[model samples]
Target: MEVKIRNRSRVMQVLALAMFLSLVWAYAQLEWGVPHTVKRNVLQSRGSILASDGSVLARSVGGQRVYPQGVLAGQVVGMMGETDGLEGLEAAYNRSLQAGENLKLTIDPKTQAAAEAALAQGVKEHHGEYGSVVIIETLTGRVLAAASYPPFDPNNWRNYSAETRRNRPFLDTYEPGSTIKGLIVAAALNEGLTTPTTTYSTPMERYVGGRWGSTIHDAVPHPPTLTTKEILRYSSNVGMSHVVENFAADKERAYLSNYGFGQDVQIPVVATATGRLQRPSEWTDLVRVTSAFGQGMSSTTLQLAAAYNTLANDGLYVSPRLVEGTPAGERREVIRPESARTIRGLLQAVIAEGISNAAGLKGYALAGKTGTSQVAVNGKYSDSLFDSVFAGFFPADAPRVTIAVTVHGATTNYHGSMLAAPIYKKIAASVISNWAAAPQQLPKP
Candidate 1:
């Protein structure tokens, strides 16, 4: 009887062991198998990103994300990671993209190509560390092109550095130098403080910020006296100081803020810099003078383009848009239409009569301003390094497109008029040709 009872107990122990083994196998399968299947299914179902013309910018195939137009608007389209987007628009709208929804962009492929080509040539020719070009449609604020040089190839993004992958138009910020002069001048016009023909005694150098403060100098030799129109044409730093000399600091900050400086531009891209604009309380005489000429302040290339677009759009500030189906950007009257028109006319004169004549197209009425700001190294401005910039709009009488260009750390030919202006011309010419833009009669200088 005792032997039979011991045998029954052994049988019971074996059955328990078998049950434990089966449970372990089921748990292992649950841990490894189901998630793998779901991941595979998710990747296979990932959606595509399309340009405005339905050309595929990014799409998933064979469980991999592919960029058809390699290095073409790559930074703007961005790249996907092992399981998600890593940067740019991909990252901006990752959730919808992962859910198998298509993201359509406002980027025009031909315009993007033209901008990239022009920017590449200019940056290479000038030996710049990097550069970016942003083209915004005047009326809609749709970004036609946003090109960054040393282009990032989404297909091979791992090979490039973060700097190369950076969308400089949105992410990078620099003191815009004299480009801000146009905005300041527009404010002066709005306030009835000055007119296009108003005159200021613009010496080559002046102590507008008081003798103990920094002395401002004009980039090029100009007359001791210059009209407000000529001040813009010459891009005279000293003249900018004089224009804003009587302009109060709080009011200046208000105008800049109204124009989108120091304010979030609310672009879809990640980490778009608002670009530093100090409080009015921080404004000293020297700071005010420097800010007038685009020092003591900084702005992204997109912000600069959009500000010029406000002038192009007849005083209406349209927030720049990248993704389609997104709500249209905030539109507000930043300045009086008359004041905006006056600014455009003055900028047109700059292209026609100033050093920016290189940007002029034979038949198209172009308007723009050039900026060359010394780069700050450590804590002080570096004499050797500079940021060359150009901001302009085409068919100035009735503008359709606004463009902003920047070449950073150029080794030679660093002036905005020398490098950025010509680049602007090349891009504008290509765009005009691509669109077969009608020729407008150039206004008399």
Candidate 2:
């Protein structure tokens, strides 16, 4: 009986030891001893994204990715899936990020915050369906701020609509309306086809091509005749039609193409759209004329901002750079420096005495253009909805920054000067204060 009890106790002791060893082994596998594949499945560590000032935008916390400031750059920084990037800058630099490379963005936190605040306010006040703001360093082509409205938090991305997830400045395109007039005028001046003082018979409306073609009209009534500079100031579609009436279709396309249309503008972000511009072969007289004042074609806000930055950079077109390693694109002189200067002066006049006069800043020169384009829905244009836009460079005498603001789907009378220019002014003022970018004196002639 004693031997039997001792044997039973020994067996119980061995079973208990075996169970303890199994638990220990399972813990080891779960903690650190598992296969690499299994480990990868369980462990997720992503690199961090920092602003120019070293503030964290997105980072890994407790093995899970988190955006510290919630929606600081929700759409711009993009979101990540369990294993990899899904959109935005995260997707653009996915490989590097997955390899644990930390990224420092060109975005200025203060500038970005200011842009977002102003954009949100403008969109709400104007009852816009959506809005976007893009700011770029004129000389270096660095993207300082890219703000998209209908604020989203990546942490709860599923709750946000796809429209909010989209990076509007990079993906959305629209007929630029009169904002395009600046480029058209620049092209005309660059080609020596006309000067700022060149005069045209400025009717309110003019028919184009045959009856099949649409008639172009100015947004507001204008004088019977006006100079090129005055046409730009007033944002006259009819006057712009006259300015580009003699321009060949191929030349017009070439100029617009050189200004960064009809191509994907590469930044350090995955989402990009090559805005739709019809081929030269498809250009009818109406199409060509309408395109002169920003219709019958499309361009993203970023593309437009970069194109305008060309003028701010003395006619040098430099593609935007968002990542630290990527260099500013090669400089291509799209227009004569003199032509750019002339256009800048004309744009300044737009704020000084034109419809955008309210956009003027005290003690500082401002230059910009406003656009309000009708939106097309289901292959037909909608009369009730419009996209209002503004594009400009600040401290007009010495350009340091270029900005573009667009408010989409305005139900009310959508005038760029009314809906978009104020937003631009608000953001620009903040940017100027944030960077202390005030100019000392005008550059020498």
Candidate 3:
């Protein structure tokens, strides 16, 4: 009878211990969330990233993340690491994605393909080290295409360098050169400082910061005087200097800020650059003159596109969006509607008569500006290296698409007109031909 009693006690103790262990496990779960093993299992079934048309850009298969679209939009869609995201949208929306929540993008596959093809071809043909192209819907500021090259294949991401994997449109910043001329001219019009017909003495080369200051030159040879429209057409740095001479340095900086310079472009990317813009207090005479003609400041390709979209959107600064259903960003007026329209007309003249004439399509009314800025090496600007850029909008009468293209370190044919403009033209043509509505007739010069 004593032996039987001892056995019963031992059984009771075993049951009590099991219950105690169960309670402790429950408490741990409630306090610290799911354990790592279970969490990893959940991550193995990570959600897909889809385009607006419901095509999968990224998905997990057999415990490995796969990019279905291959190199197309690879930088924007991004790839995964061993257990988490490594770059682009993957890194930006990691937690939600790991929870099996799908992320939809505003990207259009056709537009993205066009942009990638043209950018890759241009960069290769021009012998550029790298390049980026961005296309934003004019009214909504939705990013339709953001392409970078040399192309990255997330399926084989390990093969590419970090520079190749970088989203250059949002990350790389460079001096935008003459492309900023359009915005500067737009600001002058907005502030009632000048009209398109306003004339300035535009010598080919002239000392900008008084007689002792550095000299600025015009790339194209033109007559002694140029109207504001002609200044943009010829890309005359001297003429731009005169236009902004009386414009206060502080006001100029304000205008740049209004145009989205030196501001964080809050997109759902891992890391984005707020391009360098010096304070008004830092603007010396030389800085002001150079900044007027698109130097002494830096901007990303995406930022440049958004700035041009301001004019395209009738002076409204619709923040560029990448993800579908994301809250719209700042929507404010940067210029008067009339001023925006006037600037549009001026840019149209640029395609018709300016150095950017090569960017024009046969049947489409396009407005754009070309930029070729010297890349600064160490402390000084390099004579051999250049960043070629083009920014434009189509259907000039009522713009629908805005595009910005930049090619870095092109070894040959480095001019924006020769290299970047052709790339823009090809992408614009493809976009117009494939998905865009029939473009109206080209506007007369």
Candidate 4:
């Protein structure tokens, strides 16, 4: 009887062990499925993003999406999810990618790297809170590089904030400061209202629309009288006010809209910010005067680059291209070729002798404008905060590429010339080195 009882006890113990192992196996299966649920939803193989030269920017390997270039063009290329893309070109071309179609972007890998390095250095050296750089092929409107500073590694995107992941060139809008002066001047030139040599009796400070205490000031102390070219070179607000005197508010709005302001630009990516501009009906004298000098209006770096591209393309505004095989959009003659050339020359003078002299490259004609605008805080302009910008193209006589750089929240070297111009110079030189086989000699203006 004792032996039978012991045998029964042993059998019971073995059964209990088997039951526990079965439960353990079930728990393991459920836990494993939980983690793979996100990935299991994907039904197809994802595609990849490549540079114009076939360098991989982002790709899938062993069922894991990876950015081989790491942080290079992170915001521009964006990141992928288990099932689809999240931002930038990834999100824009999600459907095509999911269908196993390869995407070749217009982004030049070398130029993108150069832009990233230059911007990163600038942000660190200048102690800037943030910065952005954009370069576009003048004729093709192909985006060579769209780099935002303090770049985040898409490989570890969760570690970064939305601001760090933001595609600034396409999304972030700020008062373009003096950068818009060139466009305003271009508008004036296109209207035949003023010549580059046309002179204005510019004052250091003047009341807007003759409204007392509503004053606009120039950054540099200018002469009592200056020419239209001089106004651009000096980036004089008061001079711009006088230059736009012939322009009606409605006419200015038309010109602005024609230049692709206040409209979302559809690239291969989902970049949509037309930037904010007051309607024609909302334009008061103060608004008009401030808008003339790049205040009272806001634009993205991409918009600024496109506007500069107009000058580069000899007055034709081309939509920016991201994917290589994408069709070129309709090219509209917004400004006369002659007017665009004149403005280009005026901008060259800005680099050659004006506030943007720091941006000039040796043996190449650099044409760009510098903008320094006060940051608006809580609907009022801040006293100490500022955003600085430089926008221009290289080889002014025969343009190849257009570049725009903006540095935000600059506390100390806040002027565009002081902070942004150097960055522009670095990026321009790097891009020229990569794009041009033999650098063309530009004549001294």
TM-score of predicted structure 2: 0.88
**C-alpha displacement of 54 in model 2, angstroms?**
1.3
Clashing pairs in 2: none
**Per-residue error at 273 for model 1, in Å?**
1.0
Writing each residue's lDDT as its tens digit, candidate 4 over 43-109 gives: 2377788989898988877667888999988998888765678887888888998888889988888
Worst 10 residues of 2 by lDDT: 436-445
| Cα-based RMSD of candidate 2 | 4.7
lDDT to native, each model: 0.89, 0.85, 0.89, 0.85
- Angstrom error of the Cα, residue 312, model 3: value is 0.7
TM-score versus the correct structure, for each prediction: 0.92, 0.88, 0.90, 0.90
Highest TM-score among the candidates is held by which one? 1
Structure candidate 3, residue pairs in collision: none
Estimate the lDDT of model 1: 0.89
Model 1 misplacement above 4 A:
1-37
**Candidate 1 global Cα RMSD:** 2.8
Which is the better candidate, 2 or 4, if ranked by TM-score? 4
List where candidate 4 sits over 4 angstroms from the true fold: 1-44, 211-213, 355-357, 436-442
